[model samples]
Target chain A: MNRNRSVFLLSALVFGFAFLYVPIISMIVFSFNESKLVTVWGGFSVKWYGELFHNRRMLEAAWLSVRIAAVSATCAVIIGTMAGFALARFGHFRTRTLFSGMVTAPLVMPEVITGLSLLLLFVALAPLPFIPDTRGFSTITIAHITLTMSYVAVIVQSRLSSMDDSLEEAALDLGARPWKVFMVITLPIIAPAMISGWLLAFTLSLDDLVIASFTAGPSTNTLPMMIFSTVRRGITPEINALATIMVGIVTIFVITAGVLMARQERRRQLETRGAGR
Target chain B: MANPSYVTLGQRILAGLDKALTTVMASPPYRWSQGILRRAGVTGRTLVIAVPWVWLLIFFLIPFIIVFKISFAETRWLGSPPYAPIWEWVEGHALHVKITFANYLFLLSDSLYVQAFLSSLKVASVSTILCLLLGYPMAYGIARADPSWRNTLLLLVILPFWTSFLLRVYAWMGLLNNHGVINQFLMWTGIIDEPIVMLQTDFAMYIGIVYSYLPFMILPLYSNLEKHDPTLLEAAVDLGCRPFRAFLSITLPLSKPGIIAGSMLVFIPAVGEFVIPRLLGGTDSLMIGRVLWDEYFLNRNWPVASAVAIALLLLLVIPIVIFQRYQLQEASGEQQR
Candidate 1:
């Protein structure tokens, strides 16, 4: 709380923010550059945005990524919620340690190893009637579900553990079935965690490049894969335009989520203070 | 009989089925079914546990097994499956299965693979230290800020993470390229006579890794630092301890778990980081992730690639195991409290 310490802290924060945001802001500014060259600043123009709009390949890839992320996030939430419930509620099952370890493994697993192993699994199982023949949308979705569900489970587990369990116990004691208790009482309480988990999964799926690259077929190109391949060739104004649009969309979502969470926290604090009074 | 006549058809069917079920339950063969019926709660819990368990075992654990098995198999040039089967039975005859340790042996014998592994460790370790030094101050700042401003500050820290990671790296490309903004600015300001060669260098790779993984470091540290009781620091001050001394003795020691968790999170993935080194590093930058990619995709050597991956997994297992143990200990410690 000292003045000198505060000054130092403030400067550190400023430097950190600058490090994080400068490149992103520059990219956004250059997206509208009239000059074909990225570094050279010609007068602002919307031509690259037009080019981005007209690029069919980019559009399709982006749309495909959205669909994959959506489906994968939903599936991850459902499975993760179940896993989280088991971890928090079931005291000590037979395979508890193994279950927890498996659920948390993907959090630290390298993308390349994960991608390769999953690819190998799919190929080995391709002969089965239930398994699909080619790696594409479904394969990517399955891989993503495996990847993101671990994150969701961890999030949901922590939320559940910190939550008071009296409401759930009361419901059960009042003759409600366990399933009914969970559905009516626990689900609503854990809904925020579930939503956050879904958002995390969605963004993770959306941002992934390495795993998608390995798992995707020749025909199935996610947006990150497209951007990576294009960037490998060279920087293009079209990419800058695309990236700017992505940044805008993600920023809106993040701000909305942040506002909602902060408001919820404030309300909870007020309620506690009122009770104390 | 009069009651039966008055009864609805649905009620009659239910009554009949109920009677039949009771009759079946009376039989010795159905005793286990009756027990299960009595323990419906256990059944439900079991179902909840079973579904995700089976899914992870199939999709997560089984793949690792497959990778492990493939790593031991021989590479076959002329096969539909690429890798020769570990065990094969020919017509009425069993051919001995040939499992090769050669791929792993090859990895050991070849200096290229060993160098890549060592260099990857070096790069990942150095980047992790840099992230800690940079992240610690920011985390401390956020943790010490006014309560009203803390949420907004944390949100700012996480905002860049939501954007496409590849785009963030690409933005760096535009900045670090010889003809890019950084160079342009220096020339314009008369700081340099010419644009320095910055792209495709170790410096660029470090920047990319640090930029990408900084949030991973800060969030954990912030969570840890935020929970410290302010009274402890005040007590230290009352004891005539210098502020810096208090921080080093009290705050830093308390934040050890956070430091470890964050560093592990950053370090493990950074070791096998394919994208950053590939995009930002030059030809001399032969990180293991890139080596694995080339071995699999470029050289068309599945077995060797699998071996590299398995080796990487083995190297990583020690830290992961240690971290898991720490987590388990912490969880139990909390429960005890």
Candidate 2:
């Protein structure tokens, strides 16, 4: 029985891993392929990555995407932190249920609806005041921020709920002003959660194709939108190169963050032990 | 002695000011309306928590109002722009401020829209079921694995997400195309004579959806299943129940929340999925998302598109309500526990 179970598990792992990794491996290998055909293997070359660099449209889109993600993620982090704080700290409020629902609405709400609604909103509200044209960078940033904020709020709120409240109270009792107490105590304590939320929001903004497609104008074509349009035309090696680069960047960041977090935790443990002694 | 008195007097003055501020900040009307956040002082904490409220109200809430507006509007002749209501400039003329339901009428009257909506529901429901079945077994296997190997297995489950979603979906296009890997493998192995019509089929779409959404199902199931008490199963065995029977009665019931959550996570997105269906599914696939896309982008009928979107929202309302209620019930349960 034990042997059979082991065999089953081994097969399952192999199958699962193959399904997960094979396509990615294929794409990565094909990016370096010297031949034009995607499947057929030839001598390896870095021609595709070189080709990717020469593409000005792609480069511009990538720059725009980075700017959008940075702005949106930053705004999302701020908004999400506030919303999370409200949810976690003010749980007894009468409208807590309503607020909570609103916070989570964007997370699971269909992206198409979000896109359509925002598009309509922008068009409708354009005539009202100093809002100006809602078809450019500002609108895209606003949409990204709104969508990304829900994610941040959920992550931060979960962290806050898990943490003990007495720490905040202790800081307050120590004669620190409320602002000083929050900055010194709450912010530092929840900083990791906040950072993770920001990372998540950044990733989401970077990956967003649907909403960006709806909200973006001619000038604000994001990287994913550019890639999508290119792919719609036909398969190209440049996209493969781009995808490979993205995978590399994300892997590096995640690994580095994981190591840093582990080190920080160890340092905290050591400091606490030393203080106890 | 003078310095001590000065310090005491300054401290007293600060305390008095602080109390006065708190009272005003925490006053009933303000507190009742927005809660005790005002009392929390305009610190980073307060700002951090309150800022999203303004953002959500402006960006999130305001957009829905626009959608609601378009849902009632008449379509333009070119279908390029949504209609604004007509008003007479003369005081004696009758005002026609009333909204039209024509856009909604167009949706309800069309068989294509209904078919698409139904197809989306069917696909999402089936894919969700499949994910639960495949995911739960794998989750159980991982949870029961030796502790040392658990993380590795979990990593394997998560490995797919590291790749780009579009790339992953595009990879399916390559694999499911007529002259593709699976067909070639099957033919070379003498399993089939000719290429199977895999691409542009419901089968291919199902495979794509399941493959894409499987990780979501596995993660939740693994978390819930890992928390199962081994002794409960042991006790059931002690009471002379079969292992399978014990699993059915105790384990399955306990993991209901995870199953439901995983299903919702998979099903909700699957319903709104525009990419996979467009890529893999046949022309007859008829998913509402693709229809909505067509209406908005290709047709440029914003009113009709908004109407379609609103209908989709109404369809999702039930699942969303259930999911929200479950979450609330779970939260209060945790509090009680």
**TM-score of chain B in each prediction:** 0.86, 0.82
lDDT of 1 by residue, B1-337 (tens): 2223434443455456656766775798777874776577557788789889999999999999999999999999778678999988787877878799989999999999999999999999999999999999999999999998998999999999888889999999999999999999999999998999989999999999999999999998998899899999999999999888899999999999889888988899999999999889997898999999999888878999999999999989987886676556655544444
Local error of candidate 1 at residue B21 (angstroms) = 26
Q: Point to the candidate with the largest TM-score.
A: 1
Could you give candidate 1's per-residue lDDT for residues A1-277 as a string of tens digits?
Answer: 4677789888989999999999999999999999998889999899999999999999999999999999999999999999988988788989899999998889989999999999998899999997879889999999999999988888887777777688899988899878667755677568789889999999999989989988887788998998999999878999999989999998999899888777766766776676678
Q: What residue pairs clash in candidate 2, if any at all?
A: A82-B48, A82-B49
The regions of model 2 sitting more than 4 angstroms off are A1-13, A266-277, B1-49, B78-80, B86-95, B329-337
Q: After superposition, how far is residue A43 of candidate 1 from its true place, in Å?
A: 0.6
Best-fitting candidate, scored by lDDT? 1
TM-score of each: 0.92, 0.87
The reply for model 1, stretches above 4 Å from the true place, is: A271-277, B1-42, B329-337
Give Cα-based local distance difference scores for all models: 0.89, 0.78
